[model samples]
Target: MKQISFKNKFGYMMGDVANGLTFGMSAGFLLAFYTDALGITAAAAGTLFLIARLWDAINDPMMGVLTDKMFRKRALKHKNQKVDKFKIYLLKGSWPVIVAAILMFFAPDGLNGTQKLIWAYATYIVWGMTYTFVNIPYGSLAAVMTQDPVERSSLAVARGIGGLIGNILPRLIVPLVLVQFTDELSKGYLIAMILFGVIGLVSYIISYYTVEENIVHQVSDVESTDKDGFVKSIGVLVKNRPFVAVSIASIAMLLGMMVNSAMAVYYFKDNLNALQLMSITGLTGLLPMLILAPIMSKVVKKFGVKRTVATSSLISSIIYGALFLLPSNAILYISVSFMAAIFMTIPHMLVWGMVSDCIDYNQYLCGKRQEGVIYGCYSFVRKMGQAFAGFFAGVGLSLIGYVPNAIQTSQVLWGIKFLTIGLPAFGMFIAFIAYQFIWNLTPEKQKEVVKSINM
Candidate 1:
């Protein structure tokens, strides 16, 4: 097995930290920002999310194809020089995303309702596209960095830890900081988002400088020029059973994680009577992931990724479902949620390495590598879940007659409870079904594919 240094591993972790800071910001808080700060309707905000994500679904595959073509051109031009296909995007794309991330939250301070909506549309869509520009390459980077399964699992753990830090740190600090700036909430969001954006930019640069792409898979000249190459390649991926199953699982997994996140403000504010409590709850909930992330590779070695994810999903489903029955006491809410988060974290920590395995399975089947395409396709499916979650959070709120700053009725409170807790239970249960039945890339099968590719 090839060895990767701690520095290289840390740099790899930073890439996902970059991803989580921007994405977690939007996923966890953007909908609330829209309705509360800008006076956008819950239905309108949900529609905005759905429409933007549908556009992203179109963008991911296109970016995948473009990335592969660009890498080949650069490699051919610098035949004698070292040319890293993925890092080039990371190096150049960081600033555009930083700018986009800040602008996405800015919303221009004062605009009529329609104009604010338009600004939201333009900025968020641009941010999503720019995010894809970096995210696809970052996701693809791991497959090239190491061909060893053990090393890839370690990389996945590093990424999960970084993402949790990026995600959790904001939750801990943002609510507390926002408390101090409550008189002007919009200004608070803009200031908070700007800080996260700059942090994201620095992490991206660290990742760009630190990672070495040790394995380069070259595209043959004929394959590059084939008129139908992209389409044909996608067809191959569709036929790759493990890839298809995993992609389906991605959709379900994101759906659960996101719905829970998107509805968190409602749960904290309406159900529990203090939005500030989110910071403490988030810190407690994340403790298990903090404990589990460092030793996750060993956990994977003992139990295997597929089995681990499936079991975690099952346990998390039960715990979150039970949360739907707990009394509204904050102590009980925090404690049960803390236990549930332990299981909620395992699948996330291991899912990316499982994705890298799908890449190996692709090469084994076709004798061709398309890491960018595969990762992008997987991301595209995952975005469907995101799209639906955004739509669901909005529509679900509307259906329950949620008023942004008013005391919710018991009926509305129940809806908030279901949206935050019960929906995730449903989402987790579906994920359990997907991985337990749909995913077939057992460790034994993965070993066969890796051996076949090496041979």
Candidate 2:
């Protein structure tokens, strides 16, 4: 096996920078933007999210199959030269991603509710599709980069660090700036997304140029054109116990996190009556991840990713549950939120590594490596979780009688509290149960699988 250089890892890490800038922003703020800025009703915004992401169920897997077929053909065409199958999409899709990110926030100022809603649907769907085009390939690239479990974990850590920087910095900065322009929040979001989009584009270009895919590693055991057909490929994935377990855990974790993120602005602004505290809270939340990034790989190596994730989820659930009991003190709230954030980072850091492991396990069982399709299916479940979270946040708020920019009643406040803390805590508990009981990819099993593949 070849050693992956720091430069290769850095290049791979930068892809997540682009991911954090575009997809992270969408996850963090798109729903809020729809309701609060674009003047779309919460129910409508949630429905839009549901429709778009549900579409990803078909769209993501198809892109996976398409990319897999295209990569096989391209590699065969240029057999002698080093070919990075995924980078082509990264390069081609980068600008469209940025454009879509910008456009998703650009509802016309004079449009009525119906016009704005229509525009929202058009732009959001485009953004989701373009995001799929880029992200599925980018994610699958890690499995093919190298077959080392430790190296894959390291790559995931680097990606996690990149995501933290890309995601947290904007969370801290954009809100502070936007709070000043509360009356013109749509314009504020437009400006912020444009700036972030440019940053994301540049990051993608850097990743495209610096990253190298190992064609030999990709084709070591399987033929370049050894596709199992789409339906069978998906069947193989679904029947893989480890993949299914991880997919379910991912859905639970993301659904909780998305709902928490979607409802956070409200939690800080309305519940605490301190809009600026969002930045402070966000900054506090980021601290644990930064502190843990250096030691994350070592921890995973010792306990295994599944155990680490389960432990983290359990701890996070406890912390989230504690929030309901604590008095509404800003200092205490920030302190507890920081602790919860730290625990939450564990799963985020390990998830891609786990996904890569599932890809490996799939190859071990099925004798074919379909990185694109496997990742696409994984991404589809993740997007489904996001859609469900968005829908829950939207309709849940409506059910609770949440009124944007107005003084929220006690019922609405209680609902926000439940969505932010209770809902995610419940999600963490579910994830904990899934990983602890269902996922069985032990460290010994991982080594066995990898060694078998190489032999």
Candidate 3:
């Protein structure tokens, strides 16, 4: 097997960069495009998000099991049994995902409201499916890349960095560019996604070439021989305290993050009266991530993922709570936002490593290698978080009486502030509680798990 190198690290980074370009864009800006650009009602847009993500959540596991089945079959067929299995799907699925991204943003002219809603549903479902097709495999690729806890931690950091870069680029560019096309909002998003798609696909291609699964371990056909494999594997994972805790906290984190992202533009535009601040926040918020991402492994090693994440979650909640209390003080808000963003970085860089550790725990308890299954289940929870965030944002906007392309009412602005700032704090608090009470996967414990897996 090949040794992991800078090339592999970069290739893996590119994979998330690719994902951030498309997935991140949708997460951050797509709701605005639906509510503001297309004049779709906030309630409808939220419902669409809920249904689509729920469907995608189901697909996440099915795809996970299906991929593992493919691997077992291929492994049995080959004498060499050394082929890189997981990274192979990066190129295969990215093109369709990229294409679906563009289409989801683009609806043909002269479509009535129901037709537009139908178009949104069809396009989004396909987009979500295509995303699942690529993401399950891509996410699973990291575990096989190396068995070293430090190296896996590094990979997670790389992914966080890449996702930040990918997400940030579009986050900065799309707002600054799209706001100018107020009259052509739909066209603006379509064109932005078109540009993002090419970049995302190219990034995936780079990743496919460079990222290698150096740890040549396999899940034997033992799983296949059992009639109740998927169920039994899932039950083990559910019972895994660390995995379950991580999943719960991850759900809260994703929910709050999505709400913050989806609502940032409105907060900036309506509350701050500075749409450009969106781009500015993206740049400033990225500082800690970029600076701290390289050293995240050391940080995780020093504090342990649970402590860092749990502590960061508490600190972040305070920051967000403070932001909510500050009203419309732009300077104080921005400064505090930067601090929260910095704390938020700790979890992004460490969570995957935690998930990796949980996978190890699964291997320890279940005595089977079911990385894809666990990761997929983890992803399913995160997606549900995203779904709820989407629904929450949409419904919150409606309740606030948010109107399209016009000055927002005072109540609407207050609601935006509440959704943007208050909810995130609550989410972080949940993370802190999860870490403190539920998850017990310490760094030392992880080392022991790895050692046991190897032996």
lDDT of each: 0.83, 0.84, 0.84
Q: Give the residue spans of candidate 1 off by over 4 A.
A: 219-228
Candidates arranged by TM-score, highest first: 3, 1, 2
Error of 3 at 16 (Å): 0.2
Candidate 2 wrongly placed segments (more than 4 Å): 215-227
Query: Which tens-of-lDDT digit does each residue in 50-88 have in candidate 3?
Result: 999999999998888888777776776774668666888
Tell me how far the alpha carbon of residue 227 in candidate 1 is from the true structure, in angstroms, after superposition.
Answer: 5.7
lDDT of 1 at 86: 87
Q: Estimate each model's TM-score.
A: 0.96, 0.96, 0.97
Q: After superposition, how far is residue 175 of candidate 3 from its true place, in Å?
A: 1.6
Clashes of 2: 0
Candidate 1: tens digits of C-alpha lDDT, residues 306-391 = 78888898999899889988877667788888888898888888788888888888788777777778888888888888999999
| Number of backbone collisions per candidate | 0, 0, 0
Which of 2 and 3 is ahead in TM-score? 3
